[model samples]
Target: MVTDFIELGFAMESGREIPQFSRFEGPVQVITRGPVPAQALADLDRLLARLRGEAGIEINRAAPAATLVNASFNASDVPQNLIAVEFLPRRQMQAVVPNAACFVVPNVSNWSDFVANRRSSAIDWTRVVSRTQAAVFVPSDTTPQEIRDCLHEEIGQALGPLNDLFRLADSVFNDDNFQTTLTGFDMLLLRVWYAPELRSGMSKAEVQARLPTLFNRLNPSGRRPSNVDPGPTPRVWQQAVEQALASDGGLVERRAGATRALSLARAQGWRDNRLALSLMLNARLAPRDQGEAALDALLAAAELYRRAPGGEVHAAHIDMHLAVQALATGQAEMVLDLTARALPAAERSENAAFIASLGFLRAEALSLIGRTNEAERLRVDSFPAARYGFGTEAAARARMDEIARIGTAAQRLARL
Candidate 1:
């Protein structure tokens, strides 16, 4: 005897067919057509017993039995003992049989719904602000007012109108159009403080050209706000030195004038720490006949950093800048010594970018002292890690260009 089971009632919206499971006893048979038979009932009882044992349930507790019949296959000669039982689709079975545990089948259609049900909340800005301040090494409540009020009264007089300046600064800080606001206020401040005469002399286009340098002198430590979406391009603090040189005549008078204004402002309690440092550094690098005065100014800056408590990082940067100045001035021995001192600080602080930079400086000093091979080796060793940590792919590319130039220069000199 044979048995066949077919489930017709169960279906899914996705049009996919569902599978059915059934138990069979004695050779269950499928009938195309059948009458009520006693033997068939016996076969069903046996199948139910087998199913109950497999499911670990008693016979009475098992689900209600279903029968299958087809008129086409009915025959008198067929054994009356044959019975056919049909099982519903697994999903339908769960709905029909109370207390019968069923496993849920998953499908791709509701993936987005699952994700939407489990989504999280938005970020908290206050916590973000605190964390950002900590990461950047900025102190809590380090606002411009606290900085401005710390300077001497005489310095405040040099700043012209304090109320107007503060208002403009506030606007710059709060406005979404940071660069535009900064540029506008800085131009006005420059006119009032530095070169009142030039304000009337130059066109808007000309004023815009000179605005960047003035802005740099004003906010030397922070990144500038640019008109473009990504904001101002990253400029090294040393660019101020170049600007000072390129200013009217060979004197770098604008840089000196800006520095004096900043110093006065700082004395009056202006919190221009970064700007102040940049000005001092530019003053030291200024191309004046008075080398002794420049050296003294540079020493004063270094001393300021050295004397300040917990300013070791600032001191390290000063040391590196001094070393670079030494290299530019043909003092290779001093460059090597300063770089050597800076390396430990750079490494101890885990500033790989600084370490890599010092390595390059050391290499440059070495090359100047007729140690080409050593210089090349250091350049090759430091290039990769420095490139990664510095976050300036173009600067790294430029360094490689410089290395190539140095190699070419060495080769040419050897031929000579």
Candidate 2:
């Protein structure tokens, strides 16, 4: 646990740069730009409240107060110690980083500064001595759930850790993206991050020396008789996973990368969450005709997650895939069973999109069983989340129509 904590705080994502401890020394003030949705505004406020109550970080929601004219153009001003969260159009965000959902950067107060200094050392998280201002970019045109996910991650980064660790099963700090909201572990990390013993620019050695005493004080019960380090993630495996998931990769390259990642995980003798993730990715990137293969991989990943600690959410995510397969195969009972088991976990994790998807699937399953009224109720109940999760009424309706078509086809097949 100590090792994970230190690595999370000290390590940079690049894996080559020297570790530099950086964090905010003062209260965090946030201002938003663009057409920031009301849900986003509400979610940000809730997140700030959590930071205050759970992580003990001082933060407040601040509206845009002043217009500052810069050398090039005029924009809403963000003062020092403030984070300017700009909600860009989805296309504009994609132009910034293809397939990027959202991101945060240190030492920049607004979007312009972020773009200007993004390539320079000015935005490099490793070099910062103390955080004064930062910028968070989110896509305005995305779902409500996406908005909240981005807020949780980007704001957490703005105030705390800069790197995401794969080993963490229970944190939004993991690249797995399974845990959409901040978990208990994430809050603990932030609590320790703002603890009086640490500060910006501290070296790894300095922080390491202090962590034993610190953890004993903050989380004394977390100590175990035997501590196992899962060890560093192999760079080759990391690269393979990235290539497999990254949007820029061609289909052939992505499939090859997934295969390589799975092979590496096997060679490493890892039966942990990393192995499960590799399996899940392999399943996700599998070709449409390879449905059986995809199901097999997903089932394996689901089993792995079922046995591991902090793996409920991982299993729930896999269940979504499993439910889709069940729906496709005309296994209505299986779809209900899978979704019923998964929904609680998804809801607990505050994964709005997952909740919405599962809800729609469950409704279809009910209708297939001749439960029309119940199915209607379920579908109606799911509407708000669907609108938020799918981002628009048309998108939600399309998903419903698609699910309905699958059910109809399944019924047709059963008759044939």
Candidate 3:
């Protein structure tokens, strides 16, 4: 646990004077003055008070780290602050503050701990990737590599064949391996196979010809889909869509198809909050009709969830989705309305990411409404420094770009 804290401290101190300490510019530094006693609550308090007095700050006993570090640096008032105290016995520390923020003792020493603590919850790869990117900021990149490899191994074990196919496509697309990678047409074919409605138009030969044009336009490397005719089969189209959706490669037309799928799903009964949120995301590359449909579905979902029992957070999620969708669709009024409804729910839920997302969404909405100062403030407030896991970096960067666009748009409006 102590080692973990040291590692965390080092992570926090990256590119700073302190080797493995938080870069807290504060007046008081209450040294532990000796080994921590097994039962020294009174002594700890006295030290805390003295430190607070020296720092000219009110002694907030409620603030776990107020006395240890200056009041300004206390991240949370949780008792876990004691974990930062070096040379303290693990047992003694545990005894002193069983539920304190002092130190987090990881269950296991290595990857085995993850396996032991594994839960049945759906994995959010975005969060995992974000954490991995943050770890890159650390001096030692070994931990990030281990985490990435472990996550990949675990995901490979957990996901189904379809998901595996999608992941492989993502890898090829991201790596820009288009010549050998799956093509946009291949992904389209996969969609046709999985989703029956998309195959309404044209024959197999026409699709094959269209596939190359779409692939050439979408792939970052500008390589067309293989001309080797897979013959006229619905399977070909399904393969193409599946490949395109999974691939990291960018195909404008493929993106349009994904948007259409989201819109179609929204038209169906699958317009749940999660699905609506996904559709809103898809709106970034979707056609106007698809984007509008997604935005409407997200709004309806938010309203539905809001009225349902025990659905406040779910409703908030929907509202956040709606706000994001509104921004993507250039619906200023809708963004403001949805954000106004979602902010309270986000606060009630106390979800930091949700709150951050709300702030970002609000910033975008405010910008659209010509509120430049407020938009900028919200953007800065919403910027998250360290996300929990991997894949989150790309999402975070994208969100940041959205925030920047809002700011830029607001500036442009001001000029007008």
Candidate 4:
């Protein structure tokens, strides 16, 4: 654990610096998209204070003032010269920052996925203090334990050194993403960044030359940084797996949950086929409210799964979603093309319940394009498998019959 900190320090001592993550020139203000719990906001405030407080003392750096901006924004009511930290929902994200990556909010994050299937996003952008806008968001669904850790990491990035070091175990900079508080090593890095000698716009060479002096002053005691836990902390992978498996929410909620799980998995650089498939399904079957955005997610996930090796099952599921989106959006040619690819994949899949879903999707797509006879045959073939998925043979048959008449699969599991 301590080695993680030592390694991070050594890397910083290396002769270069990330240019975009240069420090903020002024105080930052925290704005909530909703009425965030008071305690959560307070906890975040305390974490930011780490730059100048207890964490600072460990590295011999002075603490800074703790202040939160408590107003909503508009041209008229905007706070002057303070960076805004907005906490909002994912769909509402484009409002605060139009860049696709800024779309992360509590409960949902369209934070511009790293890739559709991989789901890992480039979070570094959020921390960069752009000359025009120095801002970030606090997702409303952020876990309580994570409030401090996230603030330190994101705000730390805002201060400078905007890149994440996946190698660090002693700091929140790594993608393990489970650390909930600032570490001593992180404080040292902050010390190196804010050292008076290292000015805001110092070139790499200038910073590199001065780092050794800062390092020595900060680590005169020669204590190595260690994770709060002696062992590696829990990983985000398990959290993603659990969310993928959970069946607690309705269709829209479940899909959103899957998207988040996929995002979490992607955030940690974890790669798993099951999580990818869950994400694909959720995006493919998105509720009406999501419309084209849902289709965008489906297309991205499909492309991601398509490129991944040994993901034939996931590919088939993606195709099925593609066909679903096509038919819903009235793209007849795409429906025909996507279903033709999806049919045999369903048959080849060894999972009976999944095969039933694919079969139902295929039949629906076929009927949408003036192929009634073929649609009925496939629909009938799907019933036995669909019964298992739908929980009763009668309900499954009713669903198929409804699809045949209405040419859509709106109520397949509406009971949920």
Candidate 5:
């Protein structure tokens, strides 16, 4: 099955058929290379949890087979069922994987960096379809979240549904890495491959032939949205907004860029986009929530949105981020209200990433409010979007999960 995909090169996706594995029978093993800190192992644990529990697909979480600093797949000695996910430094990737076809995880310092470092042919792309072995290259001194984002993407590609399609807005498999976690769409593909009727070693033609029928049968109501398109592309300001929030250039440079972006947004009459950018700048720079005056400014900004010509869907985007912040500050009740404002807009739109991020926040709110079962179900539903929005490693999710678990809502609220 792997050999067949290797000859297929870049996985292509149009409207009709989705990319998937011929067979789905491998135990993914997460192993650290070199001197990885204990925390990385913990982060891997969280990633595996999301993959095994939240993927919507039933990918079993197995223990790491063994750690290998200098390793190559002999293909003979290594068990065929053992697919190793080696986490190592980026520079060490070529050394570990050698010339053998493999997937190289993309790592970015920030969104800007992500934009800069996309799709280099020098990096091997064939291993994703290879029978076994892949690498998650970690740049030195990167945050755990960054490393996890690489894992979220690279590991997922290694698993199956190898194509990274621009049309796929919600899945982590998308090039944007906007949704870090495995999303529902990703789960759908996995389910197709692993379903009892679907067997290992099927051809693309075979899978494509039967998939549409299987999907319809499995989800008669079409719970999964069509993948033809991902709504409208994000606004230019939305893309540039990252420049301001990320600690790139000097503070002066970042501030200047952000100011200009906001000014242009307003001049162009993009009220909703501007509002969202303003809140983002405030959160990253001034952090109005830290003081009464700043809080007033925030409220005034939110109020402005209410009156602005910005539509409900755009407003929902801002609300999603705000809901996450509220959750962080232990305002679970407020998060419920904040996320609620986004829900109506969310349901009315086909923005997959937006929906996933919003749903994950709602789940956080539910968990904080003690709706465990509902929250868990929502978390499972969130799948790829949760990671895509929060970084597949789910740093924000992890922090909130810890906060919600360690203390009562009141206690958490008081601490903040």
Candidate 6:
């Protein structure tokens, strides 16, 4: 029997009938356009370097607005392997894919090419044999952390996996959006992706036959016990999750959808990260009057996540929410404990926003316990990460004030 890890490898490689293996045939040269932020440029360079060092993929940033040419792929020719990445202001990006944070498409070299072929089947990823030229569009107006995240996931997709699996607990290739950065598993997958033995356009059966030996040679430690495959996700549950998380939807309907998803997860007997995610979504959609119920659901989800593999970051996210509730209710020690548990995971995951947010909460909890000096130091230390995490000084100040207000409210309630 194929281990669950191998199944995961197959699931990530092909979301369609015939396996689609597409990647840069030579050294990847990335070009950028639009009014890109200084921070974004710096992060992109770092991402490329990491890709080179960690995944053994030769990728580097090209000169700004580098000339792009339409050329056919020849394994011996290197210049035809260029991939251009453009940073568009949010408006232009949303015009292409409404509300998409970022995306990568094969067979297109620039924005105009993408716009013209957006509806055509010529840009279809499955049909592509080898990636000669592609475009990655990331928005410039979002938070710095968001920009970094987009660079990691989109560039990874441009070079490796085209599908997001919810069952993947430790990868940015997961749509759950918990793990913000590329993980060890992701790097291993990419290394496997670019292995010389694997070439573009291999059939699913062809690739499947090779993966067992490839994984054994590349990742010897992966032979350990694997998580039981949860099987394919149901379309009804997918629809429910989409409806529940839709940015613009009636609250009542969204809550109903979350409830339905939670019911479906339970019916499937899922005890993995997916079940925990369902619980978290349901808690987020809980009505204002049902605060206790929401807290209960979050606590349950946190417990489930704590037991799941690669769930430290997921548990940290839940703890962040729980810390806020604890702070609001004047449970200073509980807030401190929750933030303590969450901080290391946030830092390990390279989520500056989470680190800053947890720092602010910890400071408030410290102050509530009369550790004024320690609280002030923590608050001051959090500011740098806060600026990067929140994108602007004003936004960072707003977050600090927000946390302060929670502490003040809790103090007043305590006095009562």
Winning model by lDDT: 2
How does model 6 score by TM-score? 0.92
| Every model's TM-score | 0.35, 0.92, 0.33, 0.39, 0.46, 0.92
Off by over 4 Å in 5: 1-26, 53-65, 70-75, 90-130, 199-201, 223-416
Off by over 4 Å in 6: 1-18, 64-79, 225-227
Question: Count of backbone clashes for each model?
Answer: 16, 0, 46, 3, 10, 0
Q: Write the per-residue lDDT of candidate 1 for residues 232-310, one digit (tens) a residue.
A: 1112222333344343434556456445544544444423233335445455546668667667666665565455322
lDDT of each: 0.38, 0.83, 0.38, 0.49, 0.52, 0.82
lDDT of 2 at 249: 86
**For candidate 2, lDDT tens digit of each residue in 9-101?**
776776755467878788878777777788888898899999999999888877545423232223344467877788878898777787678
Report the CA-based lDDT of candidate 1 relative to the real structure.
Answer: 0.38
| Candidate 4 per-residue lDDT over residues 1-416, each given as its tens digit | 22333333323322233443254344444433344545566666565566666434221111222233343334444443344455555445545444332322211122222122123223333223332233555555443333334455555544444433432434455443323345566677776665566555544556566766667777777645544332322244334434544556466555655666666655645433434544565565567797677667666656655554324445666676566655555565676677667656445433445566656666766666668799789877777666544546676676566544434443233223
Residue 132 in candidate 6, Cα distance off native in Å: 1.1
Ranking by lDDT: 2, 6, 5, 4, 1, 3
Model 2 misplacement above 4 A: 63-78, 287-293
Comparing 2 and 5 by TM-score, which wins?
2
Report how far residue 405 has shifted in candidate 5, in Å: 32
Each model's Cα RMSD: 33.4, 2.6, 22.8, 18.1, 12.0, 3.3
